[model samples]
Target: MRSFLYVPGNQPKMLASALTRGADALIADLEDAVPPGEKETARHTVATWLRSLPAGAPVWVRVNSGPDGLADARA
Candidate 1:
């Protein structure tokens, strides 16, 4: 079985170190873990982190619901 770890999207340090941990996959979360005021910032941070990946990294994103979710999807 594979393991997946959850990391808050707003956390840059966690995002940078997550892939080194040994989990088979990662779930970068932008929902309940992030305060509303930081939502936009988290989106950008997550997006930038995703781009910085070396490719084929097993990372999944947990976006929020409603309009915010749509924005997350777009990011």
Candidate 2:
């Protein structure tokens, strides 16, 4: 990918605007960029955001490791 943009998962506005930024890849970050208390929220938000996109949306999610990461993967 030519451009890899990191968008904080907890920020809905950013997530919505990210897809149009012309980045080759969009990264929904739910780890260090998000507060501990917001991890779950970010997960749900990111999942929904990804789902709303069309089949060709270049999006990827970066989640914390362990249970949270596994859960994020499933999302």
Candidate 3:
């Protein structure tokens, strides 16, 4: 079985610490986990976090839907 940890896309500190939580995979959430006002910030934060990770890091992203979601996917 695989374990996954969910980290909010808007919270940088939580996102940072999630890597060490012993989960088989990490899910950086950019949708429901983030408030509407912070959506853009969350996208940037999640993108930066993804870039900072080492290659082959077991991570996945949860993006929003529609045009805004398209922006999230692009990020």
Candidate 4:
């Protein structure tokens, strides 16, 4: 069975640490876990981390529910 571990996207430390965990996938949370002011930073951080992760480990960003979420996640 696959499992996804959630980590706050704005936190570099958590992002770095999550990469080392053996979960089947990771959810870099840009939503509820992050404060409103940190949303943009989280998006950038998650995007960078997504690029650096190994080929086999799937990584996803959980965007906020607001109208800008999709745009922010893609940014």
Candidate 5:
């Protein structure tokens, strides 16, 4: 986990390729990298991405902190 990479959650191609991007950890960004209006779509994409990750993958989510973030956490 010495190195980390941040990928915008809305990019399908980047998301698909994130697993082997060589970073020690991956952050599927749902905050600033994504536009406000696209948060819902990003959340769905990030949820799918998290579920698809292989066992032992080093990943961390950076959801905004608040009710909106709580909603993302719930997703």
Candidate 6:
């Protein structure tokens, strides 16, 4: 089992840096790192980034949980 490091989905620079770190998996975090106004943007950005990774490299998305703002964030 390999560990995944949490990287802010909204920060393109950080995401790029993390992808190159040789981690077994990367966790593109849309929950804590992004502010309410940037949730949608972060989701899209993370989706795009995940698509670009190599076949063997795993990318996981950490979405917001629960109802209210958390649910909205996941949406």
Per residue, candidate 5 scores C-alpha lDDT tens digits across 1-75 of: 588999998886898898888998888888788898898999999999888889988888888778879878888
Q: What TM-score against the true fold does each predicted structure earn?
A: 0.95, 0.90, 0.95, 0.83, 0.91, 0.75
Q: Native-vs-model 4 lDDT?
A: 0.82
**How well is each residue in 1-75 modelled by candidate 2, as lDDT tens digits?**
688999999999999999788899998998889998988888899888888999977877788899978877777
lDDT of 3 by residue, 1-75 (tens): 389998999999999998899999999999899999999999999999999999999999999999879999888
Index of the highest-lDDT prediction: 1
**Off by more than 4 A, model 4:** none
Q: State residue 50's C-alpha deviation in candidate 5, in Å.
A: 1.1
- Cα TM-score of candidate 6: 0.75
Q: Which scores higher on lDDT, 1 or 3? A: 1
Answer with 1 or 4, whichever has the higher lDDT: 1
Residue 53 in model 1: lDDT: 97
Query: What is the TM-score (0 to 1) of candidate 5?
Result: 0.91
After superposition, the stretches of candidate 5 with alpha carbons farther than 4 Å from their true spots are none
lDDT of 1 by residue, 23-70 (tens): 999999999999999999999999999999988999999999999999
lDDT of 6 by residue, 1-75 (tens): 476788988998898889678778888888888898888788778777777778977777787876534654544
* RMSD, one per candidate, in order: 0.8, 1.1, 0.8, 1.6, 1.1, 2.9
Candidate 4 lDDT over residue span 7-45, tens digit each: 988898999989678888888888889998888888888
Name the runs in model 3 displaced over 4 angstroms.
none
Pairs that collide, model 1: none
Candidate 6: misplaced stretches above 4 Å? 66-75
Ranking by lDDT: 1, 3, 2, 5, 4, 6
Clashing residue pairs found in predicted model 6: none
TM-score of 2: 0.90
Counted clashes in each candidate structure: 0, 0, 0, 0, 0, 0
lDDT winner between 3 and 4, please give it. 3
